[model samples]
Each structure stands twice: as C-alpha cells, then as structure tokens.
Target: MIAADSVTVYRGLEIGAAKPSAAERARVPHHLLDVADPAHAFTAGDFTRLARPLVEGLQAEGKVPILCGGSGFYLRALLRGMASGEENQVEAAAIKASLEARGAAEGFAGMYAELVRQDQGSVSTVHPNDHYRIVRALQAMALHGRPWSELNKEARATPPAFPGLRFFSLEVEKEELKEYSRWLSGDQVQLTIHLDKEAFISLSELRAIRSRTPGTKTFGGLIASLIELGMEEWSLSNRTATSLPKPQRDKNFSL
Candidate 1:
C-alpha cells in the first residue's frame, strides 16, 4: 500500500498526523511514509516523481497498489502527471505564506474571491473550503505567468503514467460520493459501491422516489437528488447505531 497523504509525507509528524502505527506498518508493507523532512515542503509533483515508479514496479509484480490517503491533489498527480516546468518550490512557499498572512489579516473568503477573479476556471474545479489548493493555484499562476486551469489542461493532454487505471471512491455519505463523481471525467474512472443490505434497500427506495419526482430528468440532477436522500438515511442509521447506550462495567472489574 502507498501512503499518498501530504501530512504523512513528512517525517517527525506521526503523532499529529495520526499516521499508521509501527505495528500497522509491520503488518502491511507501506511506501511514501516519512520520506520527506518537515522543513522541506513536499509538492504533488515531488510525490508523483517518487510514487510513479513504485506503482509500476508493483504492477509488474502482479500486485495492485492500494493508494490510501486523503491527499486528493497528490493522488491526482500520481494518476495524471503534473504540468511541465519545475515549479520554484522556494518561491511557491513564500507566495503561499504571503497569501496565508493576508488571509489571516483579512479573511480566507477574500483570498478565495481574489483567486476566483484571477482564475475562474481553476477556482470552479476546487472546493471553496480548500484553502491549500486555493493558495497553491494562485501561486502557480503567479510563478508561471499563466492560468492554473491552462496548466491542468496541458497536464491532462499528457499521457497518464499508469494507463487503464480505475478509481473506486468509498464515501460514507452519498452527497460526498456525488461530489467525487464530478472528478471522474474519462471512461477510466468507475464508481464502486459497498453497502450493507439495509443501506442498499434504503438507497433503492430513494431511487424510486427520485424517479417519480419531476424535473429530475437530467442524469446529474437525478444523481444529486438520490445522493441527498441516501445521505439522510445514512446519517439517521449512524445516529441510531451510535446512540445505543454502552453497557455499564462491573464496579469490581479492573484492567
């Protein structure tokens, strides 16, 4: 398994990052953990450079590499290569710090608004709450003297490092799943659903209700509605499961 997480990428951040324990690593071979020093900033480009070869080597050995992490940008870079040009990491860091300072002084909303004005296309692709990517996009545009969206377009045109790759998104709520679905563009992407029988039944009922609703003609609209219903049911089930009272321990019992 490859740990493509940005937080886990740095050394000496195990406790705060909540990285897998030593025992867990011993049980399963893991890569890309503690590969960089905390002092050095790790970029998606750097991650792609390192992980691509490991993934290929694993594939040659007839092993499917499991990429486990929440670093979406890094994962995207691994799957689809980054744009040409060696991004000046030092300059990018300075720019990011400046932007962050401004965000702190003013507000992140203002920073995000400025980014939208600078690169509307790229801003649309990223979530509003994602401050890291927002600042990064602005930094890239400033350094390269081009739009982040254009760079991404160029990157997409380049042949992927791992061809015929499939993506399976595991989301707790369907709304989250639907948002991820937007990230899947080409035929190479596929959705894999794993749910309990009760959840599956709930999803089926939601689908039926969505089918009967008017103005749910478009595929996107239907998907959004079904996901909304599914999330409601999932949340209710989760609450019910967790709300159960824990069994009281015997007063005389001791560890």
Candidate 2:
C-alpha cells in the first residue's frame, strides 16, 4: 500500500492522519508512509517523483501497487505527469529548505526584501504575510534559473509519468458532500470518546474547537498528528521500555 495522503506522509502525524494500523500493514506491505518531515511542504510534485519509481518497480516485479488515500492532487500528478521542463522535486524541496533556513538565519524581512528586489512582480502579487507563496516564488526563481516571469507563460503538455498508468475514482450518491460538510462543520462523526463512558467532550467544546482550529477539515488529520507526536515523544523518552525506531526519511521503502 502506497499512502497518497498529505498528512500521512509526516512521521508524527499518525492517528489524526488515518495511517494504516500495524496489523493492516503487516498483512500488506505499505510504502510512502512516514517517509517525510511534516515541517517541509510535501508537494504533489514530490509525491510524483517518489511514487513513480515505486509504481514502476512493482510493475517490473509483476505485482500491482495499491495507492490508497484521499490526496487527489498527489494521485493526479502521479497518473498525469508534470509539465515539461519541470525541476526534480528533491532538488526543489532542498532549495526550498535552504531558502527557509536562510529566512531564519538572515531574517525573513531581509529575504523578502531580496525577493522583492529580484522579482517584484511575483512578490508584489502575494500578500506581505503569505510566507508559503513567498518561499515558493523564490524557489521558482531558483529553479527557473532566472526571475523570468514569462518563462512558464508558454503552453506545455503534461503526459502520464509512464506508459501503463491508470486512474480510478469512486463516488457516492450526492457524494453526501452536503451532509459530510455539515458534520465536519461541528457535528460529531457518529464517533464517541469516553473516560469510562462519561468523559466525553461537550458539544460547546466541539464548537469552540471547530471555531478555533478552523483548519481541521480532514477526517483524521488533527487526531493523527496529536497521537503520533505523543507516541514518538514517549518512545524517545522510554527507549529502554520499547524498541520503536524513529521513522526514517530520505530513502523510499518498498516491498
């Protein structure tokens, strides 16, 4: 199983991210889970770069690879390849990491100033506080080899990453999208928590949480992050009690 979900890629975002259980993984080998640092922005481009090899290698071995998750962006990018002349995701991510590191060391104000100096068009378009776009625009300048905003303006073709790639989507009646949205808006998801059956969070508390944590849009994103971070910390502190290794990054593991 190759997980395509964005949150599940993070090492410490297990419970909230709906990562497969140990028993489930033991039954069927999984790939791409916990292979990334949550601190970094793992783009669809990165997913394509990492997952392409896994899929191709599985085909070479005459085995079908199952990619399961709700990351529509990752799935699409992998099936339909990136546009021509795109930079490799690893290098792009590295460049982004360098830019972010310098932003910290050299002050983001100075970094932003440098960006505005180089590509005022890109820098001017985004809000002053839009840090993600600021770093991304800088990364694009680095990747494009210049601050030429006209470069990507030309039309380009996006082909499938490989010859045999296929895509399948499942849909529900009405997709239940309206109902689901309402539930996510603040209602319980037919799930209950308990401290001896009486220690449940109140509806008001849920409303407050929904209001304050407005970004809890995923079914399990928040829960997974909290549980996995706690587990990782506990394991690190009690190394003598259990033999849980910190999730490894860099290398892509396959069956």
Candidate 3:
C-alpha cells in the first residue's frame, strides 16, 4: 500500500496526519509514508513520481496495489498520469509556485476559507482534513478562474501508469471512520469514500478503531480491511473489482 496523503508523507506528523500506526505498517508492508520532512511540502506531482513506479512493481508481482488515503489530488495523479505535456507543465509549475507562496503566507486555514468562498461543491467533495486536495483544487481552479464544479474532473491527464489495471471504486457512506469501517464490515464490502467536513476522522479515533477490529494491529491492516474487506479479498480468487472500464475513472472517489 502506498499512501497518497500529503501530510502523512512528513516524518514527524504521525498523529496529526493520521498516519498508519507502527503496528499497522508492520502488518501491511506499506510504502511511501514518512518519506519527507514536514518543513517541505509534498506535492501531487511528487506523489505520482514516487507512487507510479511502486504501483507498477506491485502489479508486476500480480498483486493489485491498494491506494489508501484521503488526498484525492494525489490519488488522481497516481492513477492518471500527472503530466499534461510541455505547455501545461510550464503553466502547472507557475501555478504551483504561486499557490505554494500563498499557502506559505496565508496558511492552510486561510487558504481553505478562500477555497470555501470559491467552490462549495468542491469543498463538499473532499475530506475536510485533506489539506493537499483542498489547496490543489484551489490551484487548479486558479488556472481559468473556474469553480471546481465547472472544471473538467480530469486534470490534464495523460496515460495511466498501469494500463489494463482496473480500479474498484467504493464509497463508504458513513461519515465517521469508526462507524464507517464497521458498517462496511457488517455489509461485507470494500469501498472508497467521499466525505466532507464532519466525515474526517482523527488519529486517536482511528487508533481506537484499529484496536477494536480483530487482527488489525496497524494502519495498513485497519485501512486494508476497511478498503478491501481483509486480505482474503485479495486472494487469487476474486478479480472482479467493480468500477469504470477506463482504468480507474471517477477521479473523486478513485484509489
């Protein structure tokens, strides 16, 4: 499992970022967590550069890689290649610099308020705690002064890294993570989630939930169970992951 979260990528932000616990990582063998310093911000392009190869490797091993996180921007970049050709790339870089400067000056809370003013639909689409997705959406919206709802869901995407790699997009409807995971378990389902402000869960809550779910000792195990219905779901037997045919479409709730 490769985390697509921007904050979780930092080394010392475990609690705030709701990073997978040490025990959870021990159980699931996750990649790309705690790989950056908190002083520096991790971008969606960086996620794609790192995660694309990791997912490819997992596919080569004949095991489907599960992307578990709340950062829709990073997830979309990983699933659909991040490059948008030369001209778009140049524009993206300029936008990135501008947004980074804004974020640095205004702070996430201020930027988030600005985002709320611009796009309520977008504000409702992503998890409230997903800082990267919120700021990144602002960046994209800035490109043409368009609200997120009016912009194309696909953002300058190219080819996906893993072609013929089907995606299983599931929406866990419950708002709270604790209730949501249990609900999914009771129903015996694995799904991705689209949550707004109240839906975001804290680290302590997630840790408590992990302890309650049998055999889930770490973040990897807990998330794995919630997102894929236990390791048995990945058993060589079931290959029918329901979703779009175009290799992980629906950017909002995709892995």
Relative to the unseen true structure, what is the C-alpha lDDT of residue 66 in candidate 3, on a scale of 0 to 100?
A: 85
Runs off by more than 4 Å, candidate 3: 83-97, 100-160, 164-255
Q: Where is model 1 poorest over a 10-residue stretch in terms of lDDT? A: 187-196
What are the clash counts of all predictions, listed in order?
A: 0, 5, 4
Model 2 pairs whose backbones collide = 15-224, 16-220, 16-223, 16-224, 17-224
- The candidate scoring highest on TM-score is 1
Tell me the tens digit of each residue's lDDT in model 1 across 126-231: 6677666676777788889898888878877766667777777775888876665555433111321322232233333332212222221233354557789999
Best by lDDT: 1
Q: What is the lDDT of residue 203 in candidate 2?
A: 27
What are the TM-scores, per candidate, against the unseen true structure?
0.58, 0.50, 0.47
- In the range 119-200, model 2's lDDT, one tens digit per residue, is 6665445455655556666787788766623332321234555676556779876769777767656643333232222112
Please write out the lDDT profile of model 3 over residues 88-176, one tens digit for every residue.
Answer: 65676678667756765777777777777888877666555555556557777766677764553444334665667656666665567
Clashing pairs in 3: 23-218, 24-218, 24-219, 170-192
Between candidates 2 and 3, the TM-score winner = 2
Candidate 1 Cα misplacement greater than 4 A, ranges: 60-63, 83-85, 174-255
